[model samples]
Target: MNDAEVLMNPNDLVQFLKKNPEYFTKDDILRFCEENHVEMVNFRYAGGDGKLKTLNFAVSSKEQLDTILSEGERVDGSKLFSFIEADSSDLYVIPRYGTAFMDPFAEAKTLNILCSYYDGNGHPLASSPEHILRQAEASFKKHTGMEFKCLGELEYYIISKEETFYHRSNRIGYHESGPFCRFCEMRTEAMLMIARAGGKIKYGHAEAGSFTKDGYYYEQHEIEFLLTSPILAVEQILIAKWILRRLSVKYEVEVSFAPKIAIDRSGSGLHIHLLAEKNGTNVLIKEGKLSDTAKRMIVGILDISDAATGFGNTVPTSYLRLVPNQNAPTYICWGEQNRSVVVRVPLGWVDGVDMAADANFGLKRRSEKATRQTLEFRVADGSACIYEMIACLICGAIHGLGMNGALTKADELYASRNIFNEECTSFLKTLRRLPISCTESADALISKRKLLERDDIFPPGVIDDQAAKLRAYNDSCLSERLRRDETLFTECAEQYLHIN
Candidate 1:
């Protein structure tokens, strides 16, 4: 801990210090503390609100550090969640060694790792978000003999401290480098930090949304991660959010994930692409068309999109982002290459073309046909309870697989063309719609609670708590009121600008 001991740079990956970067046992983590002259150990985990919580321990000696890491620490559940009773609030937070990382901005040499909650009987707490996701995966694999994998398209806006010379038009700042995108450098550094913290990233880029707000400039950016298991994806996303918020402090700016930043500005969405795997191979694509299991998942998501909004769209103004023609889905439908529907089947090398051969001469190789097929659900946004949101989706998929008439429902909800177009107005009227208010979302969840409670993966307390909180907003009529009042609209939007 001396000043003369050279400090490790933040961009340096801590996994390099291990024999295997992907494996981190207790002995390996303990050896890291001893060999690297570590001074502090931090235990981080997700709480009821889906925010990362931390409890720090200063390593007085190797013995003290060992005990802290092995035995874990106790926490008050009542203070962290609304559903937990105050009388029985004691719970344990145990560290997950695989998530260890070097704290980038730490003044002291510190090692940070994520943790999981455990009950008094030394079992994972059923109400824990981490446990619920793990259970869902196991149940899904047991029932359908398939694994659930997801890819998240994380979107956010970076508000610079002052205005820049480049005047980005509303919803037109997609992929401009150097001068136009002022926050490109900051966004890239965040990507590196996320990578160093064990995130599998695909790419980062500018998005098609920008606006000046509250005397500051705001430009949109997105960082997409590669496909991973549902549990791993959720953890990576929470870590990414933590790193971005911390990095924003150094640059003296604000980073927000609110669904609707303004009335007409392009809202940020947490779009997720879901893939199904069986026997170590992707089963999502069959014979160059949508597979049966994949179709069921799409229909399942469409069936529960309205109810699932309780977990995704948390705030009152989130309803504003789901309006028609705003690049957000408003109806219960699926489509291929159409953005107007809730579930979209993107171009996934369906035609069997070797896309990489033309770009690289030496890399002229064909695909194994085991990957690249995905069904993207675009209903959720940034203010989501990520653990429950994903769990709900997986349950719906399982239910869809077992339900009758899935093929019929899928065909009925398929939209070949944009349903909002002038020619398809009558067709759009026939389809069902998403919830437009907090109250409506709560009512949908209340009615469809059995869907989520089927496998016991989703705790009843969590479901009840979520419904109660959503109903408490009483904002079912707020959207109608805000339409005629601009002053009140801005005031409501400002409160949630940095809520995530």
Candidate 2:
């Protein structure tokens, strides 16, 4: 038989990894490649925009493996925005062994390993998004002896070309089933695929925005994941998006994770929930109340709400979804169960009840002590890179934790009531609103660069580069709008009404 026909099965490799967790050494990989007749390996990494970049190489001998593991594969760093200048564009892709997985979709039997970017001298790139996130995690650990556990509620719209025959209004698709929920089977299959690929899927369901017309149908859906380490959570977000995009093409549908797909429709959001933990215990809760550290972190995020949006809400269309009373927060405030505020401490947990009512009654009571108290930051959308958003959040929390008594006062005032209510109008006058436009948000990031850049969490010039890029993007959008219709700039409110 030929060498290819005598090679070990990819499934066998997966099982081998599961059985022997210590098989991550270079020697082990080389041995496996030699014995299994493996032909190629793929190295992947995330760019500044969270898009995946890949490098592939043949794995014929042990010499090549040793060279790659020791020196890494060089790549063109200039391809990624803000990474490097054309004069010194050389960077290396060093594989992160823990992120190794077999490519189920590849035509050949290949192993895909996620990698990190490093400079020519083997130093980690400061402008690298993954590196920034790792530094943030390290900083948080240094200050509090705790790590962050994060979960993402990723929402998106799926449009199909198949005919629906009958039509429905654009505003009623929440928890939909049967004929109206045309994408149920597809979403379920995607969720299963994600689970099989090592992602922890919490749930998937239809959202509250959909419409059916002529021979096309558009529906909103959400896929929420369970809490995990910050790095793993971010990696899973990228993986989930990759799965969805691939499946969408297979199903003959178009998927959009844009913050706002239509002018007057429910916008998608990438709401993130986080908890601080130490020694396997959630540190955000103590005696059924928010711990001092938790309060400080929340207040810190609130203090830098506008600046943080530059990373979380990166695109001009993101601001269109932040209108008041549209299930999107517009004010710089926090409150329990208040969706109108930038930060929300969801209800049920505060009253000793789980927010997930579908759990078994007995099991719910049994796991009460294990329940974690989390803070949900609701401003970010899919336009932002997960790494950048989390890094900005950690920086803000660090600043907040070191603030004086003013942070406490802001929290107390915001938690008193719904800040958007008519009765709270007088109080709202004293509070700041989130940036009204992408330009303003970029300016906020520049103004608050010192606060975010402390301790090298964000390398020098990183914030400036981010702000310049955002400004250029906003300018492009504005120019396009002006060319389409001269009155678009003057009548933006009427053109992009908040209907959700």
Candidate 3:
């Protein structure tokens, strides 16, 4: 789209607003077109597999939007990592009308649109992640009349572009604060862009990753932010990463969402906060009883832990952050405040302070009734496929709720602490660790859980292809002997489980 083709037409925009009053306003639409340097604006509806089944001009004076609508946008479908046949890579990126928004970062009146991949004839691409998530969500609702809400905390590290390899390599402990938290200015700029793009964020602040008073890194602090829904959170996460990457490039700093950077430093985690609603009430919390539905949902989560990990913590680097004794779970268990538990059902809303303080010893306590209660899952990382992971978790929970599985609590787990410890030891002896290389994970995924068989999240050959790419990624990392890996096998690390 050349510069001349992107201008907005007042008449078309006024008409567009009349049709979608909530989405577009004449002034907002005009500002969006003028600010983003967009060349054209169009809308499309695609099938479940991300195939564009239909495309039409929504509003555009620029020839670029019209050109793509008429001529189509081409992409190498084979390179999409989750699809088959790189040679049949020719695909189209059809812009979705409902997804259109202003890109605050672009110099021109650039409009942001969500797109789906499709064949030359506009057939939906099978196994598209977005489509798969929609299917999973629908299936879950069909089985259990329940909806899942998810919020993800993305934790990462930012380093100065000029920092030496030695400094980055060193385990700086809990002292890497102040100047070490590079790109504050850029982060603020990125936040503004994100806000303009409709990213509803609760707050953004410095995490514990800030260097300590003594100049060491305190890895435990997470940059927590609130989000409205799982889907929105996923979009915001990707955009945040994208924006951060751009900021890094501009500032000459390195940014990483990897789990572990050093042996002793705190590793990153993507802790997801989840809740459910039914009949306009909080199902996860009602009249003080943990709803039968909520308990069953927990069972489903435990059941699909293994399969979920492939997407939840997809990167090999994620394991580096899963070490033992890091107050992270390495076992499949739940406790009131036990950091070792994979799932923690905190007390009700009223007694939060006391419960949290007393439960600090890993004890379970009830709280005053509040409707905004939730459950926290502690084993995910930033590398996850947001759509896939959330869907899988929701489905598992739905399965549990539908089946009415046994709900295990913190006190019960501790009562059998010794037996559980012995079982953990025995299980460790027999259980295989996930692949440490991206290639290996991809390979294991191919041979063990072929993508096609697993609800078609990725195409038939996509897993294998992704695995190959992962293998290349692993080889590029420092050798295992000399590399600084997180303490994954230790006592305090968080463990992801698989349902057999």
Candidate 4:
């Protein structure tokens, strides 16, 4: 472990302390541990073999760091999933101070800290989910001379695992609460867990198919929740799923982040919002037109759009939700206020334009603080690797900015028509289509090695391994021969614990 204290800037630390004020004194942590009857903190790390290997950390006084350091632990890194392979299965997890959060579900104040994983010989695991993001951040800063901040709105489902198929009676539309009216209590617990985990709570509520035919019954039972950024958002999704699953266990049901439950309705999407700052100025916001920098960002995403789709929606069935006619982005295009388009410059006031474009759009000069701008990239889904996906996006933006790729001269770039509207068909015709299956996506990844290989953005072996695994699975199952596999159908039911 590095001897230096974690050096977050004063402003960043203040931001953290502000959102999460439930700081625990060392005594508070030990006392809570004693009272809760909690014995150890579990640490999990990926081995080179790509399997999870877990260890436990004992609770002790702050001074125990030296003692704990003396009491070493060992695990085979080659068996871990994240690392490629390890001649030595040696890996250790050293907890960082100050990350402790009381587990709300524990009877006692059970504290947990995010652990750092290192190889037996003491090398940082490059494949750890967090490590991937850190690398992406480095690339982002180097290429764009800006720091990237991200936020997301996660949409998913919480349902009874018992009822596999709902016996349709009278058609109900959105928000028609019933057995599905499982929100109120779960929302309370979810908020508590998030707050305890040091995350600011954003509101959550029912989205489509509460009780209407428009609800699209079987497939569309879902909910939407928002989080401040990638780390917290992924954490919330995992925690929420766990909480909901336990609650469902009480009711004997299940929950999942799976993008598709059935066909013809919206699949869950992890829609991301990105902003870049250089020396405290919002790089993407200027005059009327998006900054050439922002445009470059968009171009990078558009260029390698296909290669990144593997993580955006991991499952083979994710493609069903990405059809051209459906809500998902089927092509690479950006327009103002368009959903069918992959990138959308959200509608805003004339003052919202970036300063770089202000002269062109003819806006009066205003303080940067008065500026508000947002860009939406809509390809991601629940199954994504939060770290990898965000890293790829940041890199893409950097690439775009470097190439001045946003210089594409479309006549009506600012048009605000609905992306799914009739006009989009013609405009979108020039764009590429999302792969219809996971195999297709994997294939694209294998085929486009050069594009992703630049900057060593995506490690080559990662893509190859993923593709080979998918191919082997498909080959074994003979999935192509079956129009729809019963196992896949059952897996969907299993995912949500809809047991009927």
- Best model number under lDDT: 1
Best TM-score among the predictions, by candidate number = 1
Q: What is the lDDT of residue 296 in candidate 1?
A: 90
The estimated TM-scores of all candidates read 0.95, 0.87, 0.69, 0.75
Report the Cα lDDT for candidate 2: 0.75
Task: Give me candidate 2's TM-score against the actual structure.
Answer: 0.87
Per-residue alpha-carbon lDDT of candidate 1 for residues 360-437, written as tens digits (9 for 90 to 100): 775856565455888898889998988888887888788888879999999889999988889988878889899999
Q: Candidate 3 versus the native: TM-score? A: 0.69
CA displacement after TM-score superposition, residue 472 of candidate 4 (Å) = 3.3
Q: Rank the candidates by TM-score, best first.
A: 1, 2, 4, 3
Better of 2 and 4 by TM-score: 2
Please identify which of the two predictions, 1 or 4, would achieve the higher TM-score against the true structure: 1
Candidate 2, residues 1-500, lDDT tens digits: the string is: 23442242233444544433224666666666667666778888887767676789887667887788666788888887664788999888898765666665677767677888888878998878888888888888888788878889989888777563554556588998857688888888888777655566789999998975446577899999999877778887888787787789888997778787665578889999988888888877787776777778888888887898888887767787888778999878888788888888874254456545556544444445464578899999887778878888888777777789855555565746767678998878877888877788888898888877877888767888888867875543453464366356335423322211
- Which lDDT tens digits does candidate 3 get at residues 1-500? 22232232222332334433235433454455655455545343323222223233344554444455444577665555344466666877765443455544445444555566666777766556666566666666566676667777767666542343234333333423435434445556766656544455555554554343233323223344553556565666666666666666766655666666555566677777788766656787555666666777676665555556666666555655555667566556555555665666755455245656565886665554446667778777766766766766775676566553255432233312322355657544433343444554555455544322444444545444445545655633433532444344321122221100
Better of 1 and 2 by TM-score: 1
